[model samples]
Target: MAMNLPSQRGRGRKAPMADINVTPLVDVMLVLLIIFMVTAPLLTAGVPVNLPDSLAKPLDQDQKPVQLSIDDQGRLFLENEEVAETDLPQRLERITAIQAGGTPPQVFLRADRQLDYGRVMAVMGELNRAGLNRVALVTVEGTPK
Candidate 1:
């Protein structure tokens, strides 16, 4: 096998490549961006439920709101963790106590469409008794019928 040798003109060496190839970097960034985009919606809420559809406008939120979910079987979930009815009032009071300001924290209540009206009211009553009066019902956006 014949070996190739460096040329001896002046100092025999090839100068290091000064230009950076950004194509690989851009490709990697775009791949990461796509991965995040695909997974973002799935990460938004932990519990799954069949929500009623409504045409109401979405509310503007300045701070993170509390998530209170009621499943079809009438189970309550506060921030994805299950809590019993007897313990709900105290838990809500704790939430209120942890707030930094006088204004009560906003609560977004997500109830399954198949749940009984009274069951929803009972949970809402617990929230009311705990001084968490700022509550909004969460629903899927729907087209006008």
Candidate 2:
């Protein structure tokens, strides 16, 4: 007399997994967040200069402003790259020429606190000649008296 026994193959088979795996995705997202957090401060730390203190509010910008820095020695830097006084106008033209008839890009002029007013004005004059009229003098936030 043979006793009926269930096949072992059917018992070993399991249903396919239907749930999504999110551990890897969460790990990737966390890595990206950390990378951005680390590099965000570095992006804004361009051309270090002692900026003058002002009690003015920051401007609301629709686009990234061009960074024009004047060091204490009156050296000029365009977007953190050194540019000759004579070459500034041409560079500015090239930047604006990319967008035909569109409003000129805003320029954030960062001058050292010790920079002479005349030197700053001269750079501003150059900016004006290059048709870059939307210029904002960048300054540090000052404590109220």
Candidate 3:
């Protein structure tokens, strides 16, 4: 008697895959790109001010200085902290005293366009009295005449 046998389709069937799907990765990357494009302009430093124009070139330094601002109301701020004018010299002196190996901290001054020049000069004088000589005036670039 002859026996009937079933035929095998191919040599052997492939094993089930164990790799992860990557469709979600492409979607996440596109979302991140769009978020960065929308938020890039909002991360700039310095508050918007109508700075006085000057013909002088911007001062260049190795390290960025600590920013100090004087508003139109004659209010003083050190990095956004409200500080009394009388306390400025003491604060600056303390900062300089903490310097390692006698390296003085650079101080940059920003005065409002409508602020009195006398107030600005007084602040400069106080910084000078504190032995902090590395100071520069901050200004906005003007349009070409």
Best by TM-score: 1
How does model 2 fare in lDDT? 0.88
With candidate 3 superimposed using the best TM-score fit, by how many Å does residue 18's alpha carbon deviate from the native? 6.7
Clashes of each: 0, 0, 0
Better of 1 and 2 by lDDT: 1
Off by over 4 Å in 2: 1-9, 15-21
lDDT of 2 by residue, 1-145 (tens): 9965555777856556689999999999999999999999899957988898899999999998899998888888999998998888899889888755888899999999898899999999988988889999998899633
C-alpha lDDT of all candidate models, in order = 0.91, 0.88, 0.79
Task: Show where candidate 1 strays beyond 4 Å.
Answer: 1-10, 143-145
- Looking at candidate 3, the ten consecutive residues that score lowest on lDDT are 4-13
Could you give candidate 1's per-residue lDDT for residues 1-145 as a string of tens digits? 9975676774778656689999999999999999999999999889887789999999999989999999888888999999998889889999999984778899999999999999999899989988899999999999633
lDDT preference between candidates 1 and 3, better one: 1
Candidate 3, clashing residue pairs? none
Q: Which pairs of residues collide in model 1?
A: none
Candidate 3: regions farther than 4 A off: 1-27, 33-48
Clashing pairs in 2: none
